[model samples]
Target: MVFGTHRALDSLTLEVPPGITGLVGANGAGKTTFMSIVLGLRTPTNGSVSVLGLDPLRQGAELRANVGYGPERNVFPDDMPASDFVKHLAEVRGMPRSEARSRASDALWLVGLGEERFRALGTMSTGQRQRVKLAQAIAADPSLVLLDEPTDGLDPVQRDEMLALIRQISSEYQIDVMLSSHLLEEVERICDNVVALDAGQLVAQGPLRELVGDVEGVTVELTEIDDVPGSVESVVARLTAAGLRVTREPDANRMDVLGASADLIADAVRDAVADSSARVRRIEQRRRRLEDLFEVGAS
Candidate 1:
């Protein structure tokens, strides 16, 4: 997708499969632009777009019927009550009036807004408003749901609650979710697969585990033994001699081991500690982080 000379979304061919998939990128990374294209709200300047086996451009109505969208920004009417707002959207999605009303109430309850269902949207807090957006999106039970930064303005507790609700949407109803977020941690916590974009270009795409394989590093914390002089240095020497690269931090009483798989590192650490008569306080294998995807893309 392009606007004037700037390519909002560059030439990209990607497929989003079932389950909860995260759409991740930094600000202005074309996350919203991609969502717009998928929803048929913006036509791609060059290539075609499809959602749920239907062309978003040609079969827009049908595609929308099977899709739900929760925009990043709040675009609700101030005077509209929460229940009315959600019900109206379900009706727009072709649900019967009675069904839409029932679904809307149920959705509000699911989002923890049942008590406030009669309250006007203008009177709700930011967190409450965010739930309202979620309620409206899933009220019609669409096959696919597109959420743009669902936790944007939420506090830490509210963020966790919202994430749990998102996970529930997929696990309970078997709905597919493509949630866009600048928060990589949020994506890492709930998404099974991820698609990352950088300046509108596809940077990374794969299952979360495949993308962030086990990091080749292990951390070992040594128990202090005042009687054992140079215990830390002795352990380091033993580990290095055992063919493992070790970096020691005497003050912190920790060593970072590299140059081998985590399992090998652990074995080497155990052997080294036993030989040096050093007690171990803790040991853990490090895991690759999701943020590494963007770092690689930037490079």
Candidate 2:
């Protein structure tokens, strides 16, 4: 996908499986472009998009009926009541008026807006408005939902609530979700799978565990032995003799033992600590995160 000279998406070939999948990347990483293509909102300059086994370009109307969308920005009319707004969207998606109203009410209640369903959207708080956007998206009972920054403009508490609601929609409601968010931490929490993008290209896409993998080393913080000088250095030498590479953190009683795996490094640390009689403060296997993917991509 290209816009004039800027390539929004290039050589992007990815398959998003069922379950909650996270779309993660920095700003302008083609996350929005990819979602737009899946919704048939923008015609790609090249390649085809098939969402849920249907061509988004040719089967857009049918696809839209099966797919729900919670946009990043507020697009609803402020004067409209929350319930009416959600019901109107369901009706536009071809639902009967009676069913739309019922579905809309149910969705509002699910999102914790049952009491405010009839309140004008303009009078609602930012968090409430965000819930309204979510309510309308799922009111028609879409098989899949595309949420673009669903937690945008939300406080920490509101963000947590919104994330929980997202999890409920996927698990309890049995709807597949493709969530786009810059918050890698939130994605790591709820998503079963992940599709990472970098400058419109595929950085990585797979199960979250597979992509995060394991940390390269183990971090060990040691308590200083009051009577022994260079206690930390002795421990380092013992570890080095064990055929493990170690990087000592300067001005701190800590070091990272580098090895092939965390288990091996951990085993080596245990032996070294016993041999040196070092007072240990903390020891744990460091773990990689989604942010590491972008760092690797940038390098």
Candidate 3:
């Protein structure tokens, strides 16, 4: 997508299916702009996008009818009550008044706002307001839903609750979801597929597990360190000399020995203890995290 003269998305391409797909990136990384183009809210400057086999720019209304969107920012009318606003949106989408009211109530209940359905939107907490936004998105029973930072501005508890709700929507409702988030942990928890972007360019896109394959390594934490940097450097130098890729973490106390066999890591640990007076608190193999893939992809 282009915003004036600058390209926000460059030759982006991806395929989404029936499961949850995560769009992850840093802020201003074109995540939102990509979603906008797919939803037909913004047009791409160069490449084409087809959602559910329909060109969004050519069939905007038809595509949107089957695709729901929860925007990143608050766009609700605070003056209206929560139920009223949702019911109005449903009706605008061609639902009958009675059916719209019923669907709105059901949607609110689905999003865990059953007790607060009558509350004014202005008085609702940020988390509650977020739920209302989600409710509206799913009220129309679209097959595909786009959630943009659904848990943004929420407390840890609220964020967990919202994540659980999203999981239920994907599993119980049997709906395909395209969730956009800057938080890797959140996406790791809820998404089956991931598409990562950086600086308006595509980085990686695949099943979350496949994208982060089995690349196990070892992490060594030491205590009684005199000079943290010096100890780490000495250990890394020795490991490298022994033909191992030793990465000293930004915080120098911990070092990750990569692509080394378990026995080699054990030998290196033994050498580190023998050479220095540093107390070895822990040394064990660590499974790679989704954050690791993100870091590697970003670099």
The whole-model C-alpha lDDT of candidate 1 against the native structure comes to 0.90
Least accurate 10 contiguous residues by lDDT in model 2: 224-233
Give the TM-score comparing model 1 with the true structure, all chains together. Answer: 0.84
Extract clashing residue pairs from model 3: none
Please report the TM-score between candidate 3 and the true structure.
Answer: 0.89
Model 1 regions lying over 4 Å from their true place: 219-242, 245-257, 261-283
- Quote model 2's TM-score: 0.88
lDDT digits (tens) for residues 172-235 of candidate 3: 9988999999998999898999988887888888888887645567887766565544665666
TM-score of each: 0.84, 0.88, 0.89
Number of backbone clashes in candidate 3:
0
- Give Cα-based local distance difference scores for all models: 0.90, 0.90, 0.84
Give candidate 2's error at residue 243 in angstroms: 0.3
Q: What ranking of all candidate models by TM-score puts the best one first?
A: 3, 2, 1
Q: Which ten residues in a row have the lowest lDDT in candidate 1?
A: 246-255
lDDT of each residue in 162-229, candidate 2, tens digit only: 99999999999899999999999999998999999999989989999788855678889987677776
